[model samples]
Target: MPEETAKQTHFYSVEAPDGSYDLRIEEMLARIESTAAPIYMRLINGKIPEHQDKMDMAQFLAVMVVRTPGSRKDAAEMVGRMIQIRNYATGVHDRAFNSLVHRIEQGEGRQLTEESRTSLRRSLIDPSGYRLELGKEWALQHLTAADKLTPVLFQMRWRTIGAAQGFFITSDDPVVRWVEPKTWHPIYGDHGYLNKTAVVTFPLTPKVMLAMSWEDEGANAFAGRQGVDRLNRLRALQADEYLYAHLDHEVIRRMAVATKGSRPRMTTEGFGPKKFAATTLRRGRANRPS
Candidate 1:
């Protein structure tokens, strides 16, 4: 490690060696996994998790939400946006000037003074130029977010459901937040973690799933083939990149094909006067699944 990095006190103490923070995060996650392991086994064996077990499981899921590659991607993008804003605030105008010049050359058909160009370029600058490659330092932010989200997850009504037929498929980004079609809106897109209609779901295994919702309708139920298929479709729609299952089946292929054009997407948009907003829609959740 560089002398400066060695002295930085953030994720791990200054006295700790380089990579200590990463190991610490891994060990923390491992501890949560170990705690949740028995709960998972109980659910798999057709037992309802105790209240304390539920809280442990909720913490496991909450931390899982922040630890995935998809979450890291979102965090990196957020940092890029913040850097762009910082640059703009600090009067870094080179990118904006280049963007304005390119637009003028591309026949925007506007005549403008240098002052006009200077003012207009701010709106035309490409945010991608400010992107950053984040490192393990981001683990602190993830841990804090996970800590805050645990209670919200614990407060929700949880259900441990079994699939009567067919299997559940999970993905690289697997924790899924879904809203009823009736409550969905084009602009809002309806996957907000706090949305009253939103139900967060995770497949515990090929035959069982854990679902948390604000509603009380579906607790501890067995989903039939149709229900299982519906849940699988949600998994397909929400997958970040890859899917996993115990068995290789044609259903997976079919799902991949069916949801190809409509996969969930997480994006940042409204780059101009509106500024950038991180939006999580059915096409994407901010953090991915287990």
Candidate 2:
């Protein structure tokens, strides 16, 4: 894949001196809501020229909900759901573009004329530049993860889920096992794995948080404070069992401070009934990749 274009932008930090959490929330909410309105209108009017407008709306809402002060835990959960929706929307856009190109090719009954092909390619790729720049700005402004400990804690949750589920849930591999088999007492023997067994099967909510945190911190820290590079170092340190165990306690403490009063709520149901497995099996039988 081609490297994504370089982003040029900056996000102002919002630090209210009174330390009143509600005030902070209200300010951020106002900013997001105000920014989102015009974008939403543009989308509704069909005046925006690209899919980036749609993505900007999704991302803006995600930031707004996550930054809203209620329960940090709830906000985190909401952010996770938002990320999943954004990922799904991006996938749908890609499929639609591909389908359009395929139909055009079919209609032509031959390869596309060079000029036509160039136009189609430009139509598909040009808009991503603006979207990525906007996304970077939003992430820097509102998607911060509190502090350094937050990323480690987020990673812990991911690791725990993967361990309990018995396969790497966030890997890009398509054939990894995701769900484990168990007999529910109520069912008296009914058992099967839950979601598709594959890397990248689920949205990388924790990773997104960590990445955002890194960006925020990197942007804010003083020169020589070691910024996002510091995050990379922490990840390396986490590989050491003693280091990780020691830091885990710190992460829990910080999360308590950050997430205070928020309880884990299931944002959405996990992928239902392993339908993807059947599709994958069929593709295999047909000697095709899913």
Candidate 3:
């Protein structure tokens, strides 16, 4: 992707000049709400079969496409596994987590402790032109061992026919912002295996949040609408149907694999009285590669 293009759309707006939820996702939210409790549950729980979270852009939208609730509760289970890190990189997922020591004498409401805040700002956020993206170094020193103790691969597939990572936002406003925190949870009905699954979190914009494959882990990743192009990219996706269709499946797959791991497998009810393996992508989930 062109650096210029990425820059323009990375930021997102939550409101319009007239001040209503951005229309692009406004209708999407209504769908989620109207889809009934079950569809809403599937909307943000897990994107793929194996890896529950650290969901990339494509996986999240694919969940939104499911407008109807399945006949059974267990039918929502998704599955898969992944492994595609480059040789040049050990992968940010692999590293000895480092501890940080900071004294937060004071802090504002719902923010990190003052001391931790100072360290993050000085080292990560304050740097000129920095977006505070998480890297291996950031992971080692800042992020501790999340719920999972070690590195894990994630499952991924791109069935949607647009830019796999982004969607349109119907906001005319020049700016939009919202706070997102990373969290993880043990896969809900995993029986036993997926006790330590990666929580699927994605870039926000509730449409995005509702689509989150939420795990119980406390929020860690903090997303802000500071990037220069957050707004443009959202609207651009809204307008460019053909552009969205041009997807890089390979990269998206690798991304899903590199970023996280799968949850415990479950059993889902098939079309009727018989229940098939839940790990299968029959629950409104599909992909080119399992």
Candidate 4:
């Protein structure tokens, strides 16, 4: 029993801001649904309004697809696009937000104002009030890119927090600063060497954090690992395809079962320098003995 218990690992309990994760997600979903419902109703009723731009409607539909449960990254990109569109549609009262949004929208990126940049830094590090989805690669890319533009602000925020409290797990490699190098894998055999991928830990705050292992190599194989089963199940249902064919009935059934409940609070574990050093010493002594 002691051995069994020792092998069982536990993560930290990190609650979302004000315990409002569900409320926030629900609000985002409702807003997206409201935006899309009218378009769907028009299509269902066969009221083909001539003024309705199919292209715009298609984009809106894409937005809807991304917002559905388990579509975090897609939703985040769609939301980013939506934010851009809104900025364009509504003239900005503050020149700062408008400028930053315009530069991002245009290929020509611009420098962020100290105040606006500070806010973005806080958003990237905390990621609480900000609704950008972390599950998607594109969303992570955007967040990373945004952070780069305001490195000073980000560094300042990081420094304010204790060293052990940040989201990323530092490594010897510099590339690990962005996304984990190990996460990048070769898509094709002839594509050349693959990079080392690392698991990125996204800390929500003092307690809650989510870790995602992004890799270019053997994504399918990695997804099969037990730790990622729940996430993979959700993604499979959303994707609706396995290799070439649709999922087996049993797989679909399992996926449905897995996703039936409400979203649970994220889990965090304290595995810092202290824990690492302690574990290493214990293993060394055990190995040295007869």
In terms of TM-score, which candidate is strongest? Answer: 1
TM-scores for the candidates: 0.70, 0.20, 0.18, 0.22
Ranking by TM-score: 1, 4, 2, 3
Off by over 4 Å in 3: 1-73, 76-251, 257-263, 267-290
Best by lDDT: 1
Cα lDDT tens digits, model 4, 1-290, are 65545541111112244642223434544565566467545543333222333333333333432333233333344544443334333332356545645665476565556776556534433333433222232332232332232222111111011113212121111011133335544442221112223332222222222232324232112122343333333333334222111224454456556544433221223321111110111111111110
Error of 2 at 60 (Å): 1.4
Arrange candidates by lDDT, highest first: which order? 1, 2, 4, 3
Error of 4 at 57 (Å): 3.6
> Candidate 3 or 4, higher lDDT?
4
* For every candidate, C-alpha RMSD to the true structure in Å: 10.3, 21.4, 24.4, 23.5
Expressed as tens digits, the lDDT of each residue in 65-169 for candidate 1 is: 876656655665566456555544433457655654666657867667778766555533433322234344543455578888888898888777788898898
Task: Give me the runs in candidate 4 sitting further than 4 Å from their true place.
Answer: 1-18, 22-25, 49-56, 68-290
Q: Please give the clash total of every predicted structure, in order.
A: 8, 2, 28, 15
lDDT of 3 by residue, 1-290 (tens): 75656342201123333534334433544453454444324434433223323232222333322211221111223211111111112112123112222122223334466676455444321223322121111111111221221122122221111122343232222111122323232343332212333222222332233212223333322224432135334333222122121245453344334423222123433222122222222212122321
Residue ranges of candidate 2 with Cα displaced over 4 Å: 1-25, 46-55, 64-290
State the lDDT of candidate 2 residue by residue for 1-290, as single tens digits: 35986652112232233522224544665676676577655433324323444344444535533343222334433443444344334334767556666777899787777688556655333323222111112333334543332222222111101112111112111111122244333333222222222111111222221112111122211212233233323332222111122133444345334433332233444532111111101101111111
Which of the two candidates, 1 or 3, achieves a greater TM-score against the reference?
1
